[model samples]
Target: MSEGVTLDRTGGLITLGAADTLWADLMADSAVPTASAALTSFPAHARMGYVLLGDRVVATVKTGSSQWSVLEIEVRQAAAELNAVEMDRQDLVRIGPFRSAAKQEPMEGTALRWRQRITRALQERGGLERAAREDARPYHLAGIDWRRILVEQTRDRTVRTWWLPRAAVRVLDAAEHTETQWLHAARACQASAVVTEPSSHHQQVPALGSRPTTSPDCPTAPLRPYNGELQGHLYSVLSRKPGTSRRVAGWACAVCRTTPATVLDHCHEHGYVRAPVCQSCNTQERPDHLYSNDIRVADHYRRLFDTHAADWLRHWHRCPGCRARTTLPLPHLAAWTAHIACRSLRPTHRDARSSRARKPCGVLRVSWTGSHSAPRSCLLTVAVDFCPSGEHRVLAQVPYREAAEQFRSWLAETAPAVAAAAGPDRLDDLPTRPRPVIADTSSDGLALF
Candidate 1:
């Protein structure tokens, strides 16, 4: 046995000649010493690369911590002819092509933005130069021709105002033609057009001698039969083979993951649908919709509270109400408050009595007093009051009231049994201590306590 080597259960330096010979050899050598000795001397900071040729094995092991180790391993592996080409041709083709293709394709967001910016910049510069070079000789012409020239200039300006961007014009013309064709097809499929009769039709009957005939003056009755088969055609087109352009284009609803729906929902606020959405999301997002209003209001209040609470806690030295140092910044406070509050308020569907019994076991309120205090100390007060028994009340001065309230509510709602067992009165009776102050050289005293 080597002096530094320590044998393990596998016996001293027993190596295998299987598919992973290099890995086996390394394992054997490493295991020969105790973990601590191996770590201190040879170390476990080694990597091995191995290739298998049917039953034949070839491998190279290198210590990641030493350059000499890698060089030796590379030389040994090269001598053993381990770097033979044995990967499947299909796998090589697929992976090789994919890697090369990825390099050639443009990155989605940034590439598109860059192209658009370049195009806009070119258009602006070219348009300005062209406009500046346009002749204004008409304005300098004889008085007799001035009026005509002025009219022509005015007409040109009007035409320019009505001009559409080339891209937009192309799209609009295409859409117009499509709409016209669709309307024509629909009409052709209908048996007859429904027309409304005039109120005076009874009195305006043609002269008695006039032959009974269909004429432009005579109104047709309502409820005409459709003569077109457009609907059937549309259904057929939509039902085509799965990867067809029509089917793909028809798959517009991102939420429900359906196709050929009533209406497409575009979440204007979110800009794009990361996935499919249906008309439900659209209806809920309508401007006049109550759901939309509620969502917007909730988001606004959440953001407002988050921002102000953060600023208040960061700048304030003491808790707003109880004047305690346990008050943390908005984020920490919010998390704690949410945890507590959710535990206290547990809404259930069993009955009104049970639900009310669960209704917020605690309440927290934060009011800012407009005072120009040094380093500003916002008074944070926490009050934990329960309803059912109406026997519990606890108040503490916390730095971030909003966070404290949130945590309190969360805890109340999520863990009712634990919360109720703790009893609200216990909070007030608990020992109170001053929080450590954070040292500040700029101030006469510590800013936080």
Candidate 2:
């Protein structure tokens, strides 16, 4: 087995210490000179070195019949200049007539002395003449030039000692970058390994006949029905499968889908379960219906009062016996019915009497035509009034049988006038036949004429 020598190929120059004196001397005398000579001969490679204080090199010269030797060359070089002199340690060796002691320590070591001597000889030979021609590029550890160190280490069988450049080493050592590279490599290797695996016999089994395997990670649940309007609540309904029970959870309006329903309406009158109703319908529709129904009843009473007033006015040529006006109230059947019903439901008789007294009576005023004016016509203005006394009174009296006969004839003749007076827009609404009344109570029993 060959013993391997360790080489520091970590880039840049490695400084040597006192223990390395012999090694430094040998390297200085042999390697440094050889390298300098090569660079000088090429004139393309740049070469340089710093001189130390303690090491020396022995050079032999042959004289006639004997060997001659000289000692204490005391040569030192730095900043690429060389000269010989006696010097103490840390001497500024290049550039001056100044003695070493004046600005620097005295120069030491034979090797450093030899280095100075050789450096002078080389400089005198015009070594720096090629400095401008030689490439002055700087070496960066991150760049390609450092790879040469690795190659050298590999060739010397010292690969383990080799390392990438400083910057590259830092990147490789980072936890995040290392983890990313590891994951990428692992995924790639796993995929490749899977590709290399042999196919199994199980793949030949029929897929249709295989027992159904439910994925353990995703369990199936039951479905639910949607009962509310499709708005904000649609998503919650769709998330469930159909035709299955889900938690009722809370109440919501079935129609509008607005929550916290305004009213729970029971269809007790129609015989069904209670259902949620929205505020808009609850607050508006119920009251409106009652109002409309009252209007219908009020209209009937108003028509009766108007008929009596018209007949009494025509018969007596004045207002009625009750001292009521001849004009009739514009019939608001709904309000009249509501007023009456409200009165009927009063808790006490006095309360009912007060309500009735407050009830509105129908009346009208007539502006009749003079004999020279348009034929048999008058302008009728109806107004509603309330009586202080809660008493019902008949304004005109005639035989009931006779009043009925006259009203029928009068209604027939006045139907067209009434229809026309209602509005030209409503002329199309004229009834084809007369609406019949069961009785007329305007004559003897005070029927409304």
RMSD of 1: 38.9
CA-only RMSD, every prediction: 38.9, 49.6
Candidate 1 per-residue lDDT, tens place, 1-449, comes to 22322322321221222212333233333211111112112111123122121111122232233211212232233223222312221111000111123234343421111112322332444432343366332211000111111111122353210111222212222222222233333355344545575443121222322221122133222212222212112223333446543222234333323222223222121111122222232222222111211111112223223433332222221122121223333322332333233334322233456655533443333222222121124343333334344422333444444455454454345444433433334335322432222221111110000
In model 1, state the lDDT of residue 30: 24
Candidate 2 is scored at a TM of 0.13
- Which numbered prediction scores highest in TM-score against the true structure? 1
Encode model 2's per-residue lDDT on 71-91: one tens digit a residue: 112111110111121222121
Candidate 1 residue spans exceeding 4 A from truth: 1-13, 16-41, 45-331, 334-399, 421-424, 427-429, 437-449
Clashes of each: 55, 29
Off by over 4 Å in 2: 1-249, 288-449
Backbone clash total for model 2 is 29
